[model samples]
Target: MDINQTTESYLLNAIQNKRLSHTYMFEGDTLETLRRYGMFFALNIFGDTPRNQSLLVEGNHPDFYYLHTDENSIKKEAVGELMHVMNNKPTESEYKVYIIEAFDKLTPQAENSLLKFLEEPPEKTIAILLTIDKSNILPTIHSRAQHVHIKGQSSDRLKELEYLSEADLQTLDVLSLNAQHIKDTGENFTKLRSAAAEFSSKWINGHSLVLLDIKPMLDLCAERRDYSLLLQLIDGYVRQALHSKLKLDIFEPFKEGVKVDNIIGVNHLTNMLDEIEQANKMIQFNVHPMLAFEGMVIISKG
Candidate 1:
């Protein structure tokens, strides 16, 4: 299983040209991916010598150190440990390397500490800050690091328009029926999210989705490989609509049926888009997945 070659080529060019930056920010959706990119680059740069692995396991690599919170590991004193290491001369390799994962989780105090370090980092020392949540990152930190983004694919949605112009009576009727159903249901956020997930899942699994259900998922979709997050969100909207519909009388315009509070109109839908965009930004910045995920639920409910 290999990743797309863009990242590999970028790193290869940097290494080959000997133009490695003092810090690199690697962002993506998959943990395994983030880990591999860091480890692979670390090994390629400093892993060849026997001392490399030995120092890594011993937690005293002169050339490389990883700061993270893990099993029996220190809580993320990332900036401090990194600064400490930078103060020392490299005992083993040609360059000092710091690989920091989840940079978005750095507390405010830590971010401040990091900002200072970034302001005047030691020479020949390289740092990589990895995150999926870019939303909450301090502007200073963002400005300090050169960013690299890795986009994944959506394996959920299927071939939606099976023959748009075709006039097969049964098929045409089915599509028309589906289209009308979506318009009839309305704008319920929670219901929409769930319906979208269910519909997409069914479609991808070789089952038919009610066209009404499929429409709203497409109404506001993600561009990259963020289809997973987008679909789950569609589910949230549906449920929200269901809960709110009891008090409101306006539920037309979803084009996909979702229950919504009477107050939830086009403006609410527009607001929801803003919120989701923020959530996606959070993911890109390396905010905790749970933080971003739960935030979506809350936003939909609101």
Candidate 2:
């Protein structure tokens, strides 16, 4: 079966077999993509009838609750409101479904507020929490929900990524398959990725002062969020290098230059990826962007 058909079959079988979980964490590509799957699964669970479909499409479905926020972080108040609404019984259907998009964006208070509800949701109430990255999700929440990894775009979908070279596409495919995110980031995506690739290349080649050498690239970032993206891109390159070194099912070798497998040990690359994740978290927690970058480099070097 094709990608669409494959996903449809999975959902249909889940519904037919009456195997739906009380809580699900749909992890993958982008919020938009996961939302589509979440809504599809919700509709299927609700019988896919015309009236139910219209109600859901128009956001008037009494049995379905949708929660999303325009800001980066979702507050406890918002989640509490959802909990309050979900506490009631479904009016129209045997099951009530609630979908929370960008679940990774929930603040610590919000996640903590949700723990009890998720752990003991009202009977016949199904919760679908969607996230682009599951790493940011709290361990408590992660443990409570059944995780579903939505597969990324297929090869045919590569047609939409015409802006990136074949090698670039291969590199990014392992990192993220969200074409919209690349389009949203626009030129900065390409530049930051290039900067990251260059930085990784130098580090693997034993270049001293690799961190200082990338200062010009750092200066080009006009926004603090850029640091997060830059760190993510660096992590991606490091991962790609690790794959190359391990002789895994990599599409291409590290795009920058020499292979790092011989130069850097697998454990070191793994540790570097961990440090990069820490740097990204530092950036998320309002650390000075440059300091986070420098700290990652200094700590990795040590």
lDDT by candidate, in order shown: 0.56, 0.78
Tens-digit lDDT string for candidate 2 (15-125): 899888888998876555677788888988998899998999999999889999889789999999999999999999989999999898899899988988988889999
Candidate 1's C-alpha runs over 4 A off are 1-3, 47-60, 70-78, 152-193, 197-302
Q: Which parts of model 2 are misplaced by more than 4 Å? A: 1-6, 152-187, 199-302
The best candidate in terms of TM-score: 2
The Cα error of candidate 1 at residue 174, in Å, is: 26
Taking all chains together, each candidate's TM-score versus the true structure is 0.52, 0.65
Candidate 1 per-residue C-alpha lDDT over 1-302 given as tens digits, one digit per residue, 9 for 90 to 100: 25468887788678778888877888764434566677667755674567676676687766787777653222336568678978787777778888887676677787877778888888878888877556668887778777888542211011232333332212222222222122223333234435555553342222333334444554444232233345334434443454344545343223344433344455555555565567667867767544654565456445
lDDT of model 1 at residue 53? 62
Residue pairs that clash (backbone atoms under 3 angstroms), model 2: none
Residue 257, candidate 1: Cα error in Å is 17
